[model samples]
Target: MKKLLTMFITFFKIGAFTFGGGYAMIPLIEAEVVDKQNWIDKEEFLDIIVISQSFPGALAVNSSVFIGYKIGGLIGAVLALMGVVLPSFFIILIVAHFFLQFRNNHIVDLLFKGISAAVPVLVLSGIDKLAKSLDKSVDNLIILIISIVAVTIFNIHPILIISFAAIYGILFLRKKVD
Candidate 1:
């Protein structure tokens, strides 16, 4: 009971304060769950991230549900999902109600600008953390370079990359293990 409440409160705070969407929430979630809460280790967190990204929904919501389920089963998943969603829900309602009135306000514009500026930094931090967790193998580096090329140069979709990577792991990496 206590654990569930704590998880809810933690997610609620994250959902309320994180200015950007799922990518921006990554660092904050990592801090709370991996660093502070000790709910999951870095490797598990990375796996959750990959799985969450593979899913079709919002990254933060999907990750939250997975983490909650891992920690506290079905009920935990519900509470965590609610905790993370409610803040955005309420804030969107408030914003939708008052946005017209504040549309022309310079302060509001500046506030948005500041938040937009910070979001990239948070995302970069998350990428850095995730990168540090990966094994320093040549194959990983080759994959990383190829992925960058595929996305930036060729403009390939991420889903395709993930699929290829999964297949490579299953076929090649599995053989190495066996």
Candidate 2:
């Protein structure tokens, strides 16, 4: 019971404090779950990030639910989900009511601009952390380069790229012993 409450509170704090959406929340989620709580290890967290991004819905929501389920089963998943979602829900409600009034205000405009500027930096930080976690093998590097080109130059969908990578790993990346 106590652990469940803690999970709920932790997710609620994350959902409440983060401003730049799912990618921005990655650092905080890693800090809390991997570094602070030890609820999940770094490798598992990375796997969760990959799996979360591969699916639909917000990354924050999917990752929170996966961590919650891993830690505390179905109930945990529900609580973690609710914790992460409620803050945004309430904030959006409040913003919807009040933002129109403040929309044209100079200070409000500046505030939003400042926040918007910070979002990309947060995303880059998350990417750096994830990249550092990966094994720096040449095969991985080649795959990374190809994936980047596919996404940036060819405008390929990430799900398709991930699916191809998974299939390639399954078919050819296996280690063999004599």
Candidate 3:
């Protein structure tokens, strides 16, 4: 019970203050879940992030639910998800009303522009952390390179890219006798 409450409160604070939306939520999650609470290890957190990205819905919300479930089951999942989203929902509703009226304000526009730029940087940092933990073998590098090239040049959908990588890994690198 106390653990669930802590999760809810901690995520509520993170979700309430974080700007720039889902990508920006990564750092907050890392600090709380990894550094503070030790609810999930870094590898598990990264896997959860990857899994969340491969699906639909908001990535941050999905991650919160996943971590919460891992910690304290269904009830915890509900608490964490509600903690993360509810404040943002209400704040958006209020801010959207004000924002329309102040749409032409230069300061507001510039603030948003700055935040939009930073969101990508934050997301990239999360990716960098994930990459550092991965085995940087030649085959893995090749798969990563192929995935990037296909996405950049051919605009392959992410699902197809992941599928191709999986198939390649299975066919070429099935566990062989050491």
Best by lDDT: 2
How well does each candidate superpose onto the true structure, as a TM-score? 0.97, 0.95, 0.87
lDDT of 1: 0.93
Assess each prediction's global lDDT (C-alpha) against the native: 0.93, 0.94, 0.86
Q: Residue-wise lDDT of candidate 1 within 51-151, one digit each (tens)?
A: 99988999999999999998899999999999999999999999999999999999999999999999999889888988999888888898899989999
Identify the leading candidate in terms of TM-score: 1
lDDT by residue for model 2 over 1-178, one digit each (tens)?
9999999999999999998999999999999999999999999999999999988999999999999999899999999999999999999999999988999999999999999999999889999999999988888898999999999999999888999998777777876311
lDDT for position 147 in model 1: 89
Q: What is the C-alpha RMSD of each candidate to the true structure, in Å?
A: 0.9, 1.6, 2.3
lDDT of 3 at 100: 81
Tens digits of per-residue lDDT for model 3 on 61-176? Answer: 99999999998999999999999998899898999889888899999899889988887888787677778877779898998998999999999998898777767867887874
Model 3 ranges with Cα > 4 A deviation: 169-178
Residue 13 in model 3: shift from native, Å? 2.6
Q: How big is the RMSD of model 3?
A: 2.3
